[model samples]
Target: MRVLVVDDERGLTRALQRGLGAEGFAVDVVHDGDSALEAATSVDYDAIVLDIMLPRRNGYDVLAALRDREVWTPVLMLSAKDGEHDVADGLDLGADDYLTKPFSFVVLVARLRALVRRPTGARPAVLTAGDVTLDPSTREVTRAGSPVDLTARETSLLEYLMRHADRAVGKVELRDHVWDAPGEDLNVVEVYVGYLRRKLGRDAVVTVRGTGYRMGG
Candidate 1:
């Protein structure tokens, strides 16, 4: 299978490239988040080994962007941060798996084998509300029959809303899930919700003054 190794450590990456290459993986290496993002979006890699704290864009940003674009290739994040919340943040941001720095190459290989062996995270069938439809697998959203262009963040937000179409989803919830905000300030949610409305029509997402926002009216 193909793999992308993203880390700024040239020496380690070279070693991994040789070792993983010997293990029968077609491995490509990138040194920074910007390069990682470009490679990931263009190539259909079977798996990815991403390091956090990358220059340009960090691992979290790259992972979020990939998920937002609906590219669900399994990811194994490498980071020096071993704190519980750090790991939780990676997982919450949509990483398939994570490895702390100084991890054993053996363990890494084993984890990659397991990840490639398993089926990807199960995605729900295409979601529909009123005239809008969303296909999670393709990250495709359509209003009526025509296509709509949405940024990565916009798509992620819309997916969350559509998944819970039955009730109101509070702005805080949206921030926590979509934006990964740590503080109480949630104006970003409102801004993105407005962005979604622009693409999905003004009435796409309903705001609950006292509660939160919900899918459709």
Candidate 2:
């Protein structure tokens, strides 16, 4: 799934982007609320990690604006403030969850999974295409009763394809969804699709000539 991480802390943002990307998520990072607003407005993200304190606009204002604009993407607020009142305020601002500073990485990942697992939320933990099954929560993929081992990037690609299975997914869309921007100059999508084909077997993914790619139903 795609996520937007909005934090003024450059180090934290980078770390999260890298870490989450490795965890099979497409991540975009912006250091301020304005840029976060712009990106969130433009793209469809699975969730947003918004910091409570920000320049120009606080997380509360940003969350309020998103709701006002009818962008109902789930938000997980981050703050140094751990008081009950602060958490309540974030919830009041329409945040789905909150994480205090110095939180556990494992716990944070679990929370993200919970947000994604909500049927009404953006990301989904389970996805299927024909006889192939993928479980994002467990990071497992099985086809025809056989387990498929995949690299992190391959897993991200397969998830995207399965989510949009039976539909034409162009190279650009794949790049946007699976690859972090600025995308690689090479034909990375084709390369990874080839890798997945080799790993998952030839019948798994189909190439649509002049279009892009798709997972067979």
Q: lDDT of each prediction vs. the true structure?
A: 0.81, 0.85
lDDT of 2 by residue, 57-96 (tens): 8899899999999998889999999999999999997899
Stretches of candidate 1 exceeding 4 Å from the true structure? 121-217
lDDT string, candidate 1, 1-217, tens digits: 5678999999999999888755545578899999999999987676799999999999999999999999988999999999999999999998889999899987898788666644364434677878888765456799987899886568767877886788888876666545422363788888988998988888888887899988774
Q: Candidate 2 — number of clashing residue pairs? A: 0
List of clashing residue pairs for candidate 1? none
Assess candidate 2 and give its TM-score to the true structure.
0.90
Best by TM-score: 2
The TM-score values for the models, in the order shown, are 0.56, 0.90
User: Considering every candidate listed, which one attains the maximal lDDT?
Assistant: 2
